[model samples]
Target chain A: MNFTNNTYLAEQLKIGNTKAYDYLMHTFYQKLCAYAYTLSHNHDTAEDIVQNVFVNIWVKKKKINPLFPIKNFLYKLVYNEFINQYRKNKPVEYLEKKYFEAVDTSVDNTTKNIEKLIKIVNKEIESLPPKCKQIFLLSKKEGLTHTEIAEYLDVSTKTIEGHITRAFKILKDKLDTEGKAIFFLLFNLDVFSEIKKL
Target chain B: MKQVEIEKIIVKYINQEANHKELEELSGWLKKNENISIFNHFVNVEYLTAHNMGNYNINKAKAAIDVKLKANKRKQRRYQIKRFSVAASILILFGFVTLKYLNFNTANQPKELSKKNNPKNKAILTLGDGREINLEKDKNYSSKNVVGNSKKLLYTQDNKTKTNLSYNYLTIPRGGNLFVQLADGSKVWLNSESKLKYPDKFIKGKPRQIELIYGEAYLEVSPSTKHNGDVFKVISKSQEITVLGTHFNIKAYIEDKKIETTLVEGNVNVKKGNSEVLLKPNQQSITITNSNSIKVLEVDASQEIAWIKGVFSFNEESLENMMKTLARWYDVEFIFETPKSKKYLFTGVLEKTNSITDFLEFIKATSENEISFELKEKTVIIK
Candidate 1:
């Protein structure tokens, strides 16, 4: 039941443990279906694509490599199956274009490196000035408005706004351009819009 | 175009909020082969982060996939049998020998008492229109607003405006348990011998309410912030619990005089008559049915909700109370031959999956042979 380790889960899958399969399904099925939905646009088609990926995993369990992260493997499989379905309907040239895009390493790298970018942002947030960090968390995490944070901290609205603005500036400076873009994408979009207003 | 501006447009496009001009710009940018990868990454990340935001019927999808997997398994089995017919015949000869050995081993052991008293995922779901459905393991039930399988029931959110709310009741009989996720995404784990009545769908801008008719239930309430600040309330016989967002357990067995509400996380207000008390994490409120007095105590919250996790955990609880809890799960009666045996306190954790005899043996050994039990049919006589 302790399948927190992807390597162990991969081994279990290879050894034909149904519990491991169920665990994988329960954990990743929803997210994978959502990802497939983005590509297929229809719910039933998306489900079929993800289901085929899982069925193939079982049918080819012997070839499972324990070292590879199961999450990325699942996403990659779902994407490949989606493309295969697309190939059956579209012309060869269109399919070739999508096939190349599908196999693009940069695209895979961007998603694979998302965890690293998130960690760097977390480190920057932790290194922020105490008052600025407090204001930032209150506004972004606690979903508090500037006035609410001011009242809670017994400070003027102007002071609370100053702390948040300073925190934003510090985070922006610490993160690279790509990191900044990903940070905006991952975090609250409202915060990004607020930065635009500033 | 700058990468940041392009990324912003991609985000907008993924969110379906891009205007005609922005869409044109995105399509133009996506014409470059390299730019398509960036757009794909954004899409992947969006899907990962906003997973719960989707309106898709995930339960239905999972059920559909399960059917496909089952069919695939059958196909694989048939293919394997065809491919290894000769090896399978020799294996079947060894299997029969092994089966004989297993039967001999089991015959030498004591009867498996747990087989009859095993708790199962079973319930009776009464729909809004008074239709009753028996739900058990591997059985599937679906309607317009709800879908349920063996272990859990899910009420899908209906986006239409409704003037009146229709209520459905799930009753967990003895030796049975059920889990239900409400239309608002709040989850309720109904313990054995419990019944819960909840709306088919929660109306926006109105307080979401549910009632526990006469049993125990652990509720993880979806936050009001997710539902336009609509508060959730749990009504029982003696008290009403109001929650903004929280995980709590309410035990209000009809046979018991007190209704106990244990808070696991977040804050909840337990209102009894005119008096209301706010409970924090690790705090519990016990309200006696006959009186207006409510007692607040500090206790281990995990022990209170251990039933949901397939364990019976006690902290110096009396043998009588322990037996009552076990009786609900095992669907057996406990009779005390020696009245003093009922007063003996026991503090230990017993796995629900274990047989009744195993628990009795453990308690007997722990009591230094002071307590003994005899299993007669469905009743355990304590001496």
Candidate 2:
């Protein structure tokens, strides 16, 4: 199955092809189940939740927009399924920690886009200057602070900050130019608009 | 605060390091919901990478899902969907499209691949002496510091000679399998129809390398600890597996759609084109030859390495695919007398020690006699 080509897959799934459905389920079952487990903390419920999301997908597949990120749709369904159980059981509560986080419905959709984008972004990231890619991965993947990244690389904090800014700028440009089709698929008008203003 | 400062504050806020005032200010900044979404993008980027999402039972989950799908259909399936499910599966389907698209010429369904006369120990080993030796089980051959005992070929390297590199090849035909040990003490279990070109000896200060010209091979690489941290690299047509010391299986058959490298132990870097996927133990990386797309997945490594144990282990493998694989092992042709039987799913283990006819019988029996097979000298007609 072509992970990047849902246009082809969407047609297959819409036709009630269980083979295609099996492929999709087989590809995503483990990851989504594990992700559900993290939220529900109940093994059976996690498995049930993941299974329900897929069952619902097979049933309601006709209503789904093929142009959209199907994987993101799957993840959103998984999230909703877990939340449905959470509402019923109340076994544990979501502790909103100290982080002043922003919630976006687009965030989940962006995740599917990010998965496809990772390959392109990684290729583009590799072509960047060594220190630049290093700093970008440190900030993004490792969640390192500018001061920590600078200390690790033995550079000034200003240099670290500069590298990060340039890294995002370069990534943004590359993604915009080469990743136009993917950008549209990943971002709705609102999120895309917000990104441009940023 | 400026936009960049707002971004910094959001990052600080997400990291849980912001003071109360900074948090209050960040909350105020997020009053415009658009900014919140943009901020969520970065937060999501962090979330996607930060989780160690563990493994789950794929077969068990799929069975559960399949049951649910079937149950749902029984209850309330649309009429159009029911009709389409019976026909129009014209999508080339999965990575394995051998017979080409039937839609191009629906009149010409695939017919008569070939005959099967059963597999035996047959291989060709070309020595550095330019001598070609035909290998069969219990058949011994020795020449030019190389000796073979039917199943395995042993190379005794001439270390004192001043040389760049000397190469030898062991080619296993479509119905043949071979085992060999290279000069570096690395053990290789070559699957049927594989061509392995290995150097007669390792260089003084270089990595040990071998090329799998085509087909599959399981390798138990000699540890770098004994060889002074030297890396061993296996190169196929489009992909390369580089390892320090690990047990891994490489299936790069030309007949197959994708080149799959499944790591059983240690670590390996499966490099194809400019992309490199580092595979931890029990993970499998598949590289599609046509599109150059690579997919990495966690697999049951033992199932992949089952051929080494002379057993077929599958988890819900399709009948057509399983027969396609079985055809190579038993060296036979599969004719689907009933095409629907091709779509039948089978699971569990079948030992290779059984005769090809017996295996087909077992399959027929296990599928509740719903599937029948006509076993001949060279063809097994499936019904």
Candidate 3:
């Protein structure tokens, strides 16, 4: 079947038609170049980045989502390619420094609220015994249910329940002693629930 | 009331297996006890899969998850070869410059290096009067001194009797690519914004000399039988570099304020004013700070010469430095929106043919930089 721009081109690539691959390359060459240039700001590197992305798309055509827009997929692929290229020759620690710096300032406002709640929960969770704290984190922060927690911890579900109960009780009493601590507890819980929805 | 019963119900609820009454009863109990309410919140939040609880990157994890999803959606072996091929192509391209440099040194040089390599690797010829001519495009023109061979472009006087050929200055523009065939069939590729001044043709018994005013250039010098100590000299702002028949690159960008000469193969001696420093393959000599002293460092030739292959090379280059390179190639002006924004540096490789937006998106993926560009006339303001 004939395809249009990115969609048809991506589809044509999937079926092993070499001609379709060429068509896709010519069409997306400039678009990919634009995206790559946006990242490195160097024409030479930008060209390399786009070339890699196109090759990757051709190779991973079958894995690509048919319904997923080709342009979006290309954008994502170009981004991932740059990250991969950066990591290969760069020291991990040095690379992480930029990563953390880039992340620290741009946290989404919506995520910030959840993060604040998680911070509070973590502080209270830390008050628990080490095992209990771990259990609580795996359950509350990691979203593991009692049975899954038992399976992961290799303990009985009853024991897993003990950890959660103890962890919950400690947080409850500490917050209650602080007066209206229940609200804090609820807020933290709400944050977790909100995260699950996402 | 036992913990086992509560645990059972929680698991059932998490699995969405709880009946209506069970759900109501569970909600009622959570409302009554603060601790149970917190515990229930965790269940509601699906904490078991919290790998994506907004703690990590959703898009990245989603991509990974997509890989897992694809395993279930289709056969894996079918795409394996294709993936491998794509990876292979990149490795080949990534190694293209190094391979070309090495091949140019050992293998028979291509009849037309310009056809095999982009003009970015070739050098430009500058007139003494300040007019720059791209030597690659002038292949068809026959001058008194310069001529193009199968792959080599040469500049030589029509008569050995002539001591001086017409003096011309050649500058490779920043982000601009060019090629030149020397008198002895050697080929040189000039990187962005570099200027070179040399004789239109070389006369016998005269040492071959070329001046590098600014920017980077790569040369694939052809070997000769006379070997009359046929020396090639590159005079830069800070130092004078001398080399025999070999493959190497000289970068003396004006804005960089430093002259860098990298040897990919063979040997060269860099003279920083009065001081002399020798360089070997994969070695870089730098004369910096106007001190007129040179420092030699061992380095990867690919990192230094990727530009000649039409790609960018970064060794943890700062954002400001990266932008300067970008500005030259894209021929745009950069205005940083935030203070100290330009100081950011990252290690990455990008090709030199993509548009401005492509590079930005590639870097934006690695870091959290909100970038929006405003174009006025021809300048780009990054916000």
Candidate 4:
């Protein structure tokens, strides 16, 4: 009697289920906003970019690929919006073009595979020592100096430095060489920080 | 440099705010691995990080979205009712989109009315004695215990006849469908270009069996409780479906090279050769014509039975397949002038009540003028 999640989402959306749209929005809204902010900078503009992306998604719900996660398409659309805004406001730079090309889809499929990197990266991070993890989050997410992190944790600066060294070693050692590919694709610090909250 | 300090230098380099000592160390690290290129962002990090994000009013945005979606639902529901139908009038609903047939006969009809070739409810009924009757729309004809009306054909059994089973064949041509209630009260709807052969009346202590020679048929089997525990069995070209009492659809068009039975309610067992698969409600059993193996998978049963409700609902169907379906219902042949037209995929619910011309126009519109249709006699030329 119960429909599977992907099929259910498509069928429900066909009849205009606001709850499915709501689930999609709430799950990806913040991440989309953060991505837009990286592009447009202005929060109002970022919100506008993300909102427009979602409106397009809602209008095109019938075309959604239920087999794959919807977030990948959302991310791609946000990227396209960023490129459009970039073209309007500034001249093209080679370094910017190269990095954008790094995300390029060689294949015809619009849905690119960023697959399973989030879970693997999260698991590797969670495996860090509690103090090391806390210090690591403070340093990368807060963009704090070691001395500031030391003050925040009530620890010596040298101890804070040691925790950072140990955290990187554990992450690198646990995931090994394969994790390097994952590390490259999902290199955004803010998104990982948001995951840490969850 | 000590490895611990090297980590700090790499972090500073990643942030792109490293001084001379760290920059030199990062170049050394880069030499160790050539793939460390993803870290560099050419844009000004200060501008990206310091940009103001205006406060977003969550309540207002949600309310605005809610209103838009509600209006779409109301509009879609109204459209579904107003524009929906299938290829057949006697049987189940059909198709992907809400379909309305396109009529090609636009010229004025003759006064005599018999000369007109307009659409009418028609099918062929072959009695057990090899006598064939051409059935017409809304005409009442009773041959022995069997009664035929424009809508459906009904068979009533005589209790004390003690006669053996007499098989009768009903063929619904490409332009129409046939709905028939068996002597045992089982109801069946045959799609256009389909043929069903069943016993005229159920003999006591025998299992009810019918054969779908070709095309599609949706059947609701009468419960076994009334049949003295006799199971109903439906035979398609490639597979056989056995059920105690249930509703299901079998699409076994010989041209498609695959026979599929989709269960709508209760459990049904599909058998191909020695391999048998049990299907739950909303599950489908697929049997390829050349293979004995049957594949079972879950599906939305509503899509399979949509034909009975007069909708040709397609979920990413190729143009060739859709054209074939239309060809059967409208009793027309398709001539493809371009090979690319076959590869085009469509997803929509088109009503069956629409004319063949309208359906072709819809396809042409969806293809953005890349495709156009011309009706020549009984042939539809696609260019």
Candidate 5:
């Protein structure tokens, strides 16, 4: 049944019918809780959200227009309460961070392993010696041309080229020989695959 | 920008050798744009390093926020209640009596609702002659092979008069329909995605046998005449509904593990492999698993057969269960993203004629679930 014409709820609320209020509360409280939980995934918050919406509705019964659809009004109350809860609970810093961080936590163990390896490599690069790392970082990480590095470093273009070639050879040898073996021991992939991917 | 242009600029920019003019333009553009920065950064970082980070955890953040909101709501509700008492006192002095009367009248009044207002409890019946019929369609019938009941339909061949008809089989799709008429003129309406295998003609000495491949069907089996066995049997996967002449509804959906036979009138002896249950009027027999244990419950026949009258009646049915009901009538698929949604059930009746969209919106309002429906050319997806 639609219950569209159920005005008994309004009448009971007006006269402070405890039973009517209880009935309405019982009928909708769970639903309100569920809606709140879906958005927040917290039981206490959901309960509070529903409870506040109902209290507001009851307080404003006198001002509720005679022609207003009660169901629509009730829904609007719940929605507004949910939004208010969301805004109050949320931190502004969360909005600035990327949205995908939460998803990373839910990944399975196998996926996490690959992720860990990636993190290790990044950390290693960050921890490299200052001069060597700067050259490597500019060539590989920052993606600078030898000519640009020479111009920026105020060195001869040939000297910049020599630095990158030397850096590449060292990086390639480490990864291809000792690095490849270590990576194989952990991840089972060839060192060449890692170097080529890089 | 071209890929080569981007790559060259990135190299130049990274080397810190770009001229002042070039550096100014690149920095300005990168600062002004997000997409460019992402692409540039993505290429510059090591592949493994860039790809490893998982998506941001919105759920955790939401949970934290929810905790704070809960405390706020508790405070707000308490304050609002106190404020309401004061405002209510003032309003009572002005229009207390009128407001109370209106509220009383409104609550007491029976809600006027269009049929098909709720879709969860509706049943779809496909006829046995390879013709699909929506039982929820309006009350007009033009002598088609399929007969549409308010909640179920009946289909039988007039081959006795025509004398040249062959075997006719009706197939119900998952979330499909099946409606059929027995030789003795008893009517049966099938639920979604159910199939009924029956013959056009009944030989005098042969038994009236119909195999229910899948889904549910309500039987109003006619009384056998002349006592030549006069037995009517419905064969499903693990259960068989044997009724001589009775009004009962048997729901044997594929997903359900039990075959439920709710008898409205007369008696139905449900034979499940090795076990059987004798059911009386208002009694329901459920054959569970392959072990043959049957559970019978006393229920209102009207509630069981309400679909025959074009109304779906549910008693504390879960949202997952409700989705099955809607799936059959509208011929759609349902998927629940969260497990908690299973705990929500709705107790209501929905008219069968309402648009699926309208029905979902109404349920979303009253039930504990949110519905997002996508109707493809031939498939309806409910999430």
Candidate 6:
């Protein structure tokens, strides 16, 4: 009954508690479906993908690791299932033309890949010059307007913009060299354009 | 191409805003295998962030999975029984005991008296010509610029040539709820016994205005940046809410003296007469009808907008106030047998799709028989 504790819920699932399964479905069904729909685009296909994921989780409950966060596990399963279906339904010519061999599509590897890219970006941001880092954090992390950040820093708005732009340029260049194209894909560069418009 | 220029093109392409030239450039860049991987990852991240889960029938989806799960269980049960007969018998016995315990705990669960008492997707849409259309589940209605299916009414973003605004009113009756998508893609979820007045099409370069005539509504306003920097405004009797783009809930029931506006995401300005206050995320502004004062408080914004997610979440709300909300949604009247029972406090989350009896059972059980309910027709007499 105590769903707040993931370990307890995992134990209950392993012991064959229908209520625990029901609670999981109620909590995460829609969100996972939304994630799947983003990949599949079709309503029925998304529902089917999510349903299959849930069924597999229950069927393999004995192997469920209590240490793993169930939410991330469910998402990984849904992503892998979507990829499986995509490869099956895609035209052979399209599959041949696009190379997916370079990508690590394994469940654990894909999640780790995304996490690694984020870690690299964070490290790069941490190494920025003090003023540039402060302005960048204010504009992006705190979601402050240019004027607000300038007021806080006691500087002209143009200076604030310059610092943010410089920070983005440095991070982008560093991340591009380190993680290749995947790093910028993870980093949000929209703040740069917002500053430019202002 | 410069890195920033290519990034901009990729962003536009993922957003489906890329022109032919941009598309050609993107395709040319994507010709490289590594660039193709980057484009795919970019699309995945963009879609994952931008896409809101549109109105999907959760109950229907749950039922579909329920059928599949039951079949899977049966198949597994057959295999388990064949492999370990003694263990399977023990499990069956344990399941029987657990079922008995559950039944005993819910012993006094009331039978649903009538299906009419259940809250449903029913509303009255009054067009500009004063014609009323009944919108309900399984019913469909469509016009040149509008479409109504099931519980949602969607206005297409077209007809930019129109000069004068033609307003429409959506009145949700007691025991009913509705979802409306405005012409500018802003979404509004109306609770039971609520009415919203909005124009058929929001003009470009003009602030989009709508009125929550009465009752409660949760809105996810489309960002003003998308519509030529035109802001969205929601007006009620007590106050006006101005938004650039935000998710907020407004409760302005006719019977209640206080009008509450809770900001969930982004920023909103609450203006009452000349006084205005800007609200941050998780902040709520309460405008009293008798006074011009606006009081701001931090609240769990998710709980305030739980109705849109088919939940009734209350935090130490008085029994009287909670009953009022239940009465509106169930289309039933509550008569307290003793005034003391009205002050009983409740803090819990209940599913909106559950019958009134289930709710009463929950309150009764939690309150330790401090309060009880007697159902007769559409009246719930609380004792």
TM-score (C-alpha, index-matched) for candidate 2? 0.48
- If you superpose only chain B onto the true chain B, what TM-score does each candidate give? 0.71, 0.68, 0.63, 0.72, 0.55, 0.72
RMSD of 3: 20.1
lDDT of 4 at A152: 80
Q: What TM-score describes the B chain of model 4?
A: 0.72
Winner by TM-score between candidate 6 and candidate 1: 6
Please state the error at residue A168 of candidate 5 in Å: 81
TM-scores of the candidates in the order shown = 0.48, 0.48, 0.46, 0.56, 0.40, 0.49
- lDDT at residue B326 of model 6 (Cα atoms): 90
Of 1 and 3, which scores higher on lDDT? 1
Order the candidate numbers by lDDT, best to worst.
1, 6, 2, 4, 3, 5
RMSD to truth, every model: 24.5, 22.3, 20.1, 15.8, 21.6, 23.4
Best model per lDDT? 1
User: B234-345 in candidate 2: lDDT tens per residue?
Assistant: 9999788889889999998787868999999999998888888899989999998866667999998877887876666666678898897787787777899888888766
With candidate 2 superimposed using the best TM-score fit, by how many Å does residue B85's alpha carbon deviate from the native? 40
Between candidates 1 and 5, which one is better according to TM-score? 1
Model 6 lDDT tens row, A1-198: 498699998999889898898888888776676566655545567778888888788788999899998878898898778765444333444322332321222223334354464566567677889988887666544546777888997999767656765665565456447655554654545667777899
Q: What is the clash tally of candidate 2?
A: 1
- Model 3 spans > 4 angstroms off: A1-198, B1-140, B147-159, B223-225, B368-372
Residue-wise C-alpha lDDT for candidate 5, range B34-62, written one tens digit per residue: 64533333222323322222222334433
- Alpha carbon lDDT at B222, candidate 4: 90
Interface RMSD of 2: 9.2
Clashing pairs in 6: none
Which segments of candidate 4 are over 4 A away from where they belong? A1-30, A33-53, A56-198, B1-118, B161-163
**What is the per-residue lDDT of model 3 for residues B1-383, given as tens digits with 9 covering 90 to 100?**
56556555554554344567766656555554454544433342232122122233223433543454454234333222122212211211112011111111213333332232232433455565666555554355455666552223456535456665666766555446667766655667766676666676666656677776777788776653354667777787758877777788887777778877889998888998789988989999888847877888889876777776666767667778878888777666778887565655566565565555555554553444444456564476766
Those runs of model 5 whose alpha carbons end farther than 4 Å from true positions after fitting are A1-198, B1-166, B174-178, B225-229, B367-383
